[model samples]
Target: MEVVQVLCMKGGNGDTSYAQNSLLQKKVISLTKPITDEAISNLFCNNFPARLCIADLGCSSGPNTLFAVLEFVTTVDKVHKKMGHELPEIQVFLNDLPGNDFNTIFKSLPTFQKDLQKTMGAGAESCFVTGVPGSFYGRLFLGKSLHFVHSSYSLQWLSQVPRGLESNKGNIYMASSSPPSVLKAYYEQFQTDFSMFLRCRSEELLEGGSMVLTFLGRISEDPSSKECCYIWELLAVALNDMVAEGLVEEEKMDSFNIPQYTPSPAEVKCEVEKEGSFTINRLEASEVNWNAYHEEVFSRYQKIVADRMSREKTEFVNVTVSMTKRG
Candidate 1:
């Protein structure tokens, strides 16, 4: 699939919009606040830049869109105030796929700005927010322009579906039934995409800049572990039911694969080290219950999801890392 053209969360503030369904992501932000705060604080104290440029990559529109950025700004302001240092001017960039609803975020800017004013007082006027539309697997900022970078609950998404997936039939992702070759293809794709991500960010961030990234991951080395692949496995089950009933085409279903990967902590560490651009300051893992249900899909899928949830611990393994750009 053309992930860049199609891989976006549902837009607007309606009942089924991502804005309403992103409690899971919001919970993630809350869970990782300390890591984010520490990174921003460390970046601020290192150089104390007059203008702090911050970018939130894959910042899909919704209440969670600016949530992390505000926290960063608040952290810097709090630290500077306590240290008796002048607060820096904050430049915030919210980036996502071009298909994202930047309008909704733009409309919410007035309230976001007001909130910042309450926190930063006079220095709030110096804080500016901009929307950058594109993929984060490539460059999105000028060289050495950013002081701090944060990406949450994204980056698991591959730029596109991996090739050689004809053998991965009847599965939407790397499932327990997937062939060994299918698993290798997925891992290689993640290695390439993730390495590119680190290289791009390294070029954009200053030597002392910090980055905190949080995304879905697996605890087990097995790519088909329930923690990471079960959700999509359930999804494939639902689609197969539709196909059997003649509601969906079997060929289409067989060809479809999710353009995402949930890497294990070891897999993540491997890519980071292989890329060789950033130093890992902290790496941790946590689990959160899966709370998202799509309204667009038929009730059968929802029922399958509900049944699985009731019987088992349907949770997402989240890996959060804090790193600094190598000098």
Candidate 2:
């Protein structure tokens, strides 16, 4: 099956305010640290080699990716320092969709390298950071190569928008109410994409490697209620307004759907268990209200809410960390 390369045109034009919301950044880094530390510590303690290979799947083009990579490496360096051992050389592979704005990522690398040198000192250790564009559902590295994998805010997107929406069966993703058929299609796509993810990673990760994943998720099983994400509602309203203004075609609005699948925490755990290769180490869920007023190009179409209660109350993104010990 061909994978749909996940692309976000919304942030490609250099309007990074939406992508760099302070609350969103704090929540993402807070949720990721424990998992990242665990994975790095496990890999280092295993005594695999003098060099470590770590990858961030679905790493979009921005300073956020650079921040995350540096955070992980800094943690690893600290661990090595505590052990009274020389810091190991690290190679960070940044993987994203083929259509990603690699120019932006590449332009920021030199600055990152300088920051690394200033913080860790020139003689501490060497670290290589490079971008590799591709779908995560395929092999991006050699077998038994990677020691750790990390992804955030990117797993909820399916390989593609679900097929067969025109048959009147149902739409796969809904802004408000969802039909049973739509729910079924969403679940099936998740299962397929997630299974392919496991199969691909199983080959790329070494026997004692680890992976950390975080994404938007639903806390309830009800298909009709607003339990998933508020961004969907906001986007739906924006699309509707555009359609009414003739800025976008009506049929295109009907056919156009955001590629998303907000699986429940239990459902995610079940799928991971069934894969049988990775063992869950920790899972946690939290919510963050990522709304701030910014007089930027992207924040021009702002909506005023009466209170926090009206901003669509849904569970925060879910984070899961897992490990695989080569059997």
lDDT of 1 by residue, 1-327 (tens): 388998899999998889988999999999999998888778755457788899999899888987777888888889989888888788999999999999999999999889888887887888899999999999999999998899988989999899999998889999999999999999989998999999999999998999999989988999988999998998899889888888889999999998888888888888889888899999999999885463434477788898878887888999999999998
lDDT of 2 by residue, 87-136 (tens): 77889999888777777778888898887877788623488887887888
Evaluate residue 54 in candidate 1 and report its C-alpha lDDT on the 0 to 100 scale.
93
lDDT of 1: 0.89
Model 1 alpha-carbon drift over 4 Å, by segment: 294-296
Cα lDDT for residue 159, candidate 2: 85
Candidate 1 weakest lDDT stretch, 10 residues: 291-300
lDDT to native, each model: 0.89, 0.70
